[model samples]
Target: MKRFATLMLAFALVLGAISGAQAATIKAKGQWAFDFSWLDSGDFTSQDDDGNSDDDFSASQRFRTQVDVIASEALKGVVFFEVGTTVWGRTDGALGTDGKSVEVRRSYIDWIVPNTDVKVRMGLQGLSLPGAVAPSSMVFDDDVAGLTVSYAINDNVGVTALWARPVDASGNEGSDNNTYDEVDMFALVVPVTLDGFKITPYGAYASVGKDANFTGVTNGGAEFLSGMLSMTEFANGAIDSSSSTYDAWWGGAAFEMTYFAPFSLKMDAVYGSKTADDDAESAERSGWIVAALAEYKLDMVTPGILAWYGSGEDDDLDNGSERMPSVSPTGWGVTSFGYPGSVYRQDTYFGLNGAGTWAVGLQLADISFMENLSHVFRLVYMKGTNDADVIKNNAGVRDAFTPGNTYVFLTDEDSAIEVNFDTTYKIYENLSLVVEMGWIKLDMDEDTWADQDFSDAKKLVFNFVYDF
Candidate 1:
């Protein structure tokens, strides 16, 4: 903590000095936002299946702001900060768990190469693969120190590359599982466009070293590699200094099309593999997922469909592959709504690890109902693709194993149906009101598991977002 403060101080000082030297020209613009709204909080685990059985009708507030800096037309910087709040379902205290209400979410500088279509960014930055727009994504989604570069090949083609050291061996952050000397990550992506559609393919590689993960290594380790292991997912389950560094790789494709006029489509397909670095474990864990969405516009409304399939593990815990493992770092990326069915709201459901699952849903959206209003409604259904029993360890971050993670207790089989609705109302050029609702019911359960039946789940959330 002390080191973080000192580093921030140095950063401010350097920026101040630069401002003094370039006193002539600097451009800046940023957004200041405040939101307030009421919500329906559900206590599914509280034994009530009735909708809105326990609820409050009062509003809540949350705040956020961001600023961008442009210097010399070739150099730029940005900073983003936000505060927490109480809302539907739960409260993390308006004052965050760390007793700090404000956090620096992003801070970075961009430098453009002279006379070329190349730019480089260094400092606290965010990295992600092609599926970043989804509510959830796999590896390297958080903000961290790294170097990212991009080059434009033409109007519809471009390439990007990044290298980042997410964890240092010296932090002692995960003392109990400290088994990495350094965690390094690298990735590259390219986009090719045709007249009607564009396709983007990306790949990433990560490797860890077990050398400086132990005691008595003061000057040899790095610091502040917080939660980097989640990047490799459960594959890094228990860190052991005696084991070799874990290694993994993933590749995927993202494509979008709008050539069909009022029709549009987007899709992502990814595959990943993790090798057991130490001889103690004689097998590898791998998974794959495919998600896609297509919407067509008409005079009054637009209709769409979304579908996804994630592989699951077979009974062969020692060898057979196909478990659609998800590498969730903070469990925030599962933003893509599965439509007809998803166990929980976030990422992964009942059969994420072993014997994968599949979901499909239909969506209806339109903006012609009112002056500045838009609505989206959806219905979905999901279930496990294979009947292989669930794994005890890597069942996703949200729907974790029971008597194990202590964060959640859900031993699920498969089968579910979901209905959801979201509406946005624009109040002014810089203000809007948004509301979202969902209802979920489990269609299947683990007949053999004791007291594992899940209650029906539902939620309603709405907030106003105005900025100046």
Candidate 2:
């Protein structure tokens, strides 16, 4: 706490001194937000049996605050600072044990170039891929010290290049002791406009430290190095290794077009691949996701339809191969709507999602009822093909166990019907009260182990903001 205070004080002093010399204008912005949620469950455990466990209930709360300062034209620079904290929680083991603590979320600076379409930004900043909605399989939101440069090639096209570190070290549970030095990121984004429609195409690559061991054996094992150099020997030996690092790359193209007739459309396709180092006996895996959304605007309501399809890697047994795993939400990635246990990854040669596979859904209405109040209602359903069971038992028996001692199971046919309602009212020009209610039902085949039932989850939030 003292360290944080001291850092803030020092930053303020530096800013004051710089501004006083140049007679620059000083602008400040701040925001505060609070969120609370309640949950009701019936047999929420990930176990396979419909055990008559107790019907449990729990609630949690969170708070966040941020401040930013911008220098005047004379100084030609911008500075930002953010801090957030979770106030209460009992649903998760980590949060339930030790309470929350406040910590710095972001601090960054930017300097505008004197001429041309170029600017340099350094310090902590947010990173996102080029997509309307991030894939549930890919992680989102990394904060790192980096720089970005933008250039306007012409009236219709622009490009941006960026480099940053991989770190999401916010003051949250599981964030302590998180460190990475050999990991780096780079990206290129290009936007072109034509006939009132914009097309964005981007690509990004990350090279992380070597942490994945593909040999199926640890360094202490005699067969470890042998497994890496020769897959034939690896197949014959008993291999077990710790997690290591490697390089991962992703690229995508997207189009957003709007006609003057009150309708807009968005579509995107992305491909991701991971390359392991020599010590890791793992094979290169690749996957892709395609999504499309169309929306029509009415006087008081908007309606939209969304469709998404994701393909997993093919299984190759001869190469000591397995299907590529879906990405997990370790930090601020995609979150489950109301599922009981944390949904990590899905296995399939093609069509796998954190929620499910090959989802075709529609949202009927998003309406504004009264002044400063609105409502959103959506109905979406997903289906899985070559499904994979996510639950694991103590004995390591799965829906389908591979000869290599890997568990690759499939879920029976499953579906979820969800309805969400949200309302917001302004308390002042910059403050508001927000409330959301969600009801979900999971339907699965009788033999499946999931808690196939219906339930309601509620969230209430209040926020105050002064934007510059």
Candidate 3:
């Protein structure tokens, strides 16, 4: 990976050299950041759920920059680099001490088809698949290396597609494992706008050629339980972890309407599924996810209602029901270990593909209080759709590296409640300060964990960011 990064940087420099013949332009952007937090039982604490002791606070500081080069009307390129070890998950890279965690974040070039409305982008980059997209970082956000194409259908519509690889297998076969081919992906997205409403619909199809190393279906950030179940099957000694390949797909429509100005609605819903190669595991990979937000705007405040649900693995494996599963590259990323972009904050225990779960919440945002200053608050109620959870158990057994203070603290409880608020102040057009805090408590179904005592968690964070 280091070699590839170096090569890409060298290639971009050469491209810029040749562009001097035309009107070439180069620009750089940079950001410095800091985040400090009071430790909780969540990550840093005096005592862990497993009763271990730790620090009561944490802090992170970093700087990042990106260089943009426009060689011509049809050609452009970008180089991104960052230095820092971050616990806040705001950025992606290796953890470092003594100031050595610096790494390349993105290196991609964009090429436009001459005299046409089409363009092609290749290399390491981030791409957004627009549609009824949820805000869950582990489900909707994706950054990858590969090729992407975008063509304008018209002023109101456009189409985009991708061909990428999420996982690479080195062809090393062992007694229980065979190095498999890389996981390949193909996706198509169409965005359209009519009247005051904008809607994006997308469909994605991905597969693994051979071997069973492709784990998007069973072990992506959202659906870690699927692969876990296959492990529990180990007791039966019938299913080897690498014994099967799978195909998975996602399609959905995202809705947004602003014609009403003060009154608007936003929604994104998708159905995802996974199946054993050749339909061998007929009982797995079926689910749907939906989230909708409606708000009424006032002179200085906005009040909104939020609702969401993501299907989980069914207790009856043979039952004809679908659960939502995210692609491997989706989320903060196995590659980047990045930060959360939605309400499914990384500090929280909720996994996007927990299968049978739902939430209803209220949002109150105040923007009129001051210039460059705003406050947003949310109160949410979360619950399960199933009577009992099988995926949680399966994931519990399969997850060996996760810390007990982290995922293990998540119970079979059927419900939870969380309240959070964020206050932001823009010190300058390019600098901002934010303070975000939250309190989360577990709510359980009497039938699932009748006597278990789950502790509540809270967090207070301070962030300062400067851009240049």
Candidate 4:
């Protein structure tokens, strides 16, 4: 903690000196949050960690700040720093508080062409694929080193192009001889707006070297891709060791309609496919997913319905998975227990992806019956689309479907229901307090899971936040 403070002071002094010597303007924004939480049956299992149950109770805090140095309207440099999801009494939050926990979340620059309307962003930055019906996304969404070029053709039309390198193992051991140990991606998006309707269509492509280091990826992507690469049940090895590369592609469109006052509708549909060089029949996977949301705004609240469906694995493993592949999924769910997009400063268990499942939900948001206070309530039910035999008939795949992972692999006979209630109170212009309650009832067919049993999950959270 002391080191962090000293570093911050030195950084501020350097910035102040630079500002004094230049005409650039300096601006800053940040957030500080603390949370207290209680959770039970989070993993839906009875496993204990060194005699302690999987359930948890704890307090944690986080801090983030972004600074921008602007030379003019056309050029600027930005840097964002983050510290901790540090739990009380843990490493960085312990009595001495001497842990090294600072991270550079983003460092980028924005510039525009001198005589054209073209804009460019370069460096480490946050990026997301276009999607409707949620603040997060089911496809790629995270901070990555990349370059983006955008042009506004007119008020109603625009286009953007991007290129990113998610993994590069150029100098690593065993990588010197192989130039194919990297992953590169490219994408394009076109957005159109007319009247009260809007839509965005996008397409993305990636080249994955056979020896690509998935560890360099973030947001649960590493695990998902690693799982796909290691499935050995298929004939002659799912993804042959001799395969040189894999090609992956995705196409999607997001639509929004607000032509009718107080009523709004949003939808997204996407398809993705990945194929390995070797013709191992099961070396390829392809599928699709669609999601929609509808809401009606009233004087007291906004009532909404949300739904989604995604292709899942079929009965035959030899044909590979029918489920859609995602690089980094951050889908928002209606209920906190199922998706937890609405919760603040609280760690959640459910994987944000809606892949391999179908769900329906209803929510009442912005329910305010008292001054300075508001509430939101949601209920959702979900069922898996994958065949039960995918796991029941293959014992080798069971270890990969454990509860320790970020996302759960469910079969056709698996279902779950989730409920969430959230309350918020504005204590000051820049500070607020929030409380969240959530529960989930998970059911897995006994016939398919055999001796495996899962318990219900519940959680309660309280948070204090300040923004500047």
Find the candidate with the highest lDDT and give its number.
4
Give the winner by lDDT: 1 or 4. Answer: 4
Number of the candidate with higher TM-score, 2 or 4: 4
* Candidate maximizing TM-score: 4
lDDT of 2 by residue, 328-349 (tens): 2222111124321111111121
Note the Cα lDDT for every prediction shown: 0.57, 0.47, 0.61, 0.78
Expressed as tens digits, the lDDT of each residue in 1-468 for candidate 1 is 999999999999999998775763444444443333322323324334434354435444456566666666688787777664434234554344333456676788888999887999988766666652243344335566689999989998999998877656565756545546666778899978899988889988777665533235332121212122222233334344446676768888888888997888888788876565775242455677788878899987898887777765454444524543333333222222322122223323332221256777887878457789888787877676544254433345324333223222222365667677777788897777767676666644454233455556566655566666
Estimate the TM-score for candidate 2: 0.68
Segments of candidate 4 deviating more than 4 angstroms: 1-20, 47-55, 172-178, 216-240, 331-334, 340-342, 345-350
**Residue range 4-24, candidate 4, lDDT tens digits:** 999999999999987775888
RMSD of 4: 5.8
Report the CA-based lDDT of candidate 4 relative to the real structure. 0.78
Q: How do the predictions measure up, each by TM-score?
A: 0.75, 0.68, 0.79, 0.90
**CA deviation > 4 Å runs, candidate 1:** 1-44, 47-60, 85-99, 132-140, 169-179, 209-242, 280-283, 324-355, 391-400, 403-413
lDDT of 2: 0.47
Model 4: worst 10 consecutive residues (lDDT sum): 230-239
Candidate 2 least-lDDT 10 residues: 341-350
What local lDDT does model 2 show for residue 410? 29
Model 3 residue runs over 4 Å out of place are 1-23, 43-54, 86-97, 131-140, 171-179, 209-242, 278-283, 317-322, 328-345, 353-355, 389-413, 445-451
Ranking by lDDT: 4, 3, 1, 2
What CA RMSD would candidate 1 show?
8.0
